[model samples]
Target: MTKVLLVEDDATIRVAVVRALGQRGHAVATAPDALTGLQLAVSERPEIVLLDLGLPDLDGREALRMLRAVSAVPVIVVTAAGAESDMVRALDAGADDYIVKPFGADQLDARIRAVLRRLGSETAAGPIVVGGLVVDARARQASVDGRRLELTPREFDLLHYLAQRPDQVVSKADLLTHVWQIPYARADKTVDVHLSWLRRKLGETALEPRYLHTVRRVGVRLSAPEALGTSPEQGTAA
Candidate 1:
């Protein structure tokens, strides 16, 4: 059974969803406002969160941003806002999934299961090691050459994904779909920006990469220094 936190201000919707999810063998906690929800999220630490955008106390997007700051817990936006722009905004704000309101319990269940599956699949295989870089999936931590790399939740997720497939070229499209939980589209520089941040933290740059190598007009590859025709002792680029 999944532990779920439902953050919705509407009494009717909250009560109905609590009952519905309970019947599905889920243990659920309810919060009527963004502040209460944030507190419950930190203290209770549910497996997943079903958040509504129309909170009485705070805008759901702001709440989502705040929650992302403290936790990497999966969150699905369950709101009445069906606009594509709203969906994009929430996803960019770090929501794991998005479901328009007026949804049935079964649909919600499916989305929950799907998101869990996608995120859980990689971590289940345990830690991934490529050269001196170690990515501990279960621990949600990473280190390069025995030095821990301080990374944001999104950065860790991206690194973990690429580390799991070392030497395999991964397109930005795949990274968007998997890492960011969004589909690929032109003019999206999100992946590029995050990769730049990750590179800096890894003590490297795009022009002089050590672990993350860019394949022009193709994608990016995470491989050992030796695999990239560089000496393992070469160390991080300045």
Candidate 2:
């Protein structure tokens, strides 16, 4: 059974979700406002959080930023706003995933399971070293050139997944399946957004990558700096 915190201002939606999750053998805790939810997030320590943006006391985005400041608990933004910009903004603010409102219980449960699976499966016997980047799966930490990278759980998962298979060009479809634990959708920009964030944390960009290299239509590959030639684009498929 998963422990879930549902933070929704709408009483009807909150009760319905709680009931649905309970029926699915999940233990859910509900809060009517963002503040209470934040308190429960830290105090109750649920494995996952389903947060709504239309809160009475605080905006969910602000709440997400605050929660990220104190904890790295996985958050899925459940909002009525289906706009792509809103989804990207929530993701940028540190959401692990985003689910539009009016979604079915089965879909929600699937997302929860995916997130938990990704989190639980990231353990390795020791740190994975690629060039100057060190990804310690056991400790769930990563560093570049002796400088630590403050990655979100999702970001770490993405990097670790690639580090485990260095130099192999992994298609976004495969990445969505193995790393995100979701079916591939051509329009989904989830991988791109996370990759951008990961690049930033690694002190590089797609244009001048040090560890991660884009293989054009193929996908992304992680390689030691020595593996590539003088140009970042060299040794990588164009």
Candidate 3:
């Protein structure tokens, strides 16, 4: 039985989920606010966390960052926000996946199982290194040289995907389909926005590209700074 921590403010929804998960043979715990949820996360050491953004105290996103800073626990955001932007924000804020409000208990069960399966598989990937960058897939951590880079979960996944195929241009559609497991939609600026944030953390920009390079209408490629013949002073629009 997996120990799942459910963090939600609404007593009705919280009680329903907790009872349902318990009936499903899960060792479940509950918290009504973000601070209590975060506290339980550290103390309980659950296999996964289900977090609600509409907390009475701390914001769910802020709590997510705080949780990520100290633990590699898988988090699946359970929120009322249904917009794609909100989903992206949650993923970028370190949520492993998200379940919008009013979801079925079965759907939540499936999502939780999927996350655990993926996390289980990741343990065998070992670590990937290119130049100064090192990606530990199992730990969900990345570092540049000896300095650790605080990457969002989605950012780390994106970078790890590109690092697996250095110098190969991966299109935005591929990113949407693969990295995010979502259909490619027009007017969706998720990939670009994430790339921009990722670029800033890497200490470079699109114009003065070093690691991540845009292929104009194609996609982006990740490589070593020296391999791309880029100086540390390069700058470009992300």
Number of the top lDDT candidate = 1
Candidate 1 — which pairs collide? none
**Each prediction's whole-model lDDT (CA):** 0.85, 0.84, 0.84
Residue 184 alpha-carbon offset, candidate 1, angstroms: 5.4
Per-candidate TM equals 0.84, 0.78, 0.84
Where does candidate 3 stray beyond 4 Å? Answer: 177-182, 225-237
lDDT by residue (43-132, candidate 1, tens digit) is 999999999999988999999989988887899999999876787678768788989979999999899889888779867888889999
Off by over 4 Å in 1: 81-89, 230-238
RMSD (Cα, Å) for all candidates, in order, is 4.0, 3.8, 3.7
- Residue 191 lDDT, candidate 3, scale 0-100: 83
User: Among all windows of ten consecutive residues in candidate 2, which has the lowest summed lDDT?
Assistant: 229-238
Please give the distance, in angstroms, between residue 91's alpha carbon in candidate 1 and its true position after superposition: 3.8
- lDDT string for model 2 (119-149, tens) is 5666535788898999987566899999999
Give the lDDT of residue 143 in candidate 2.
Answer: 96
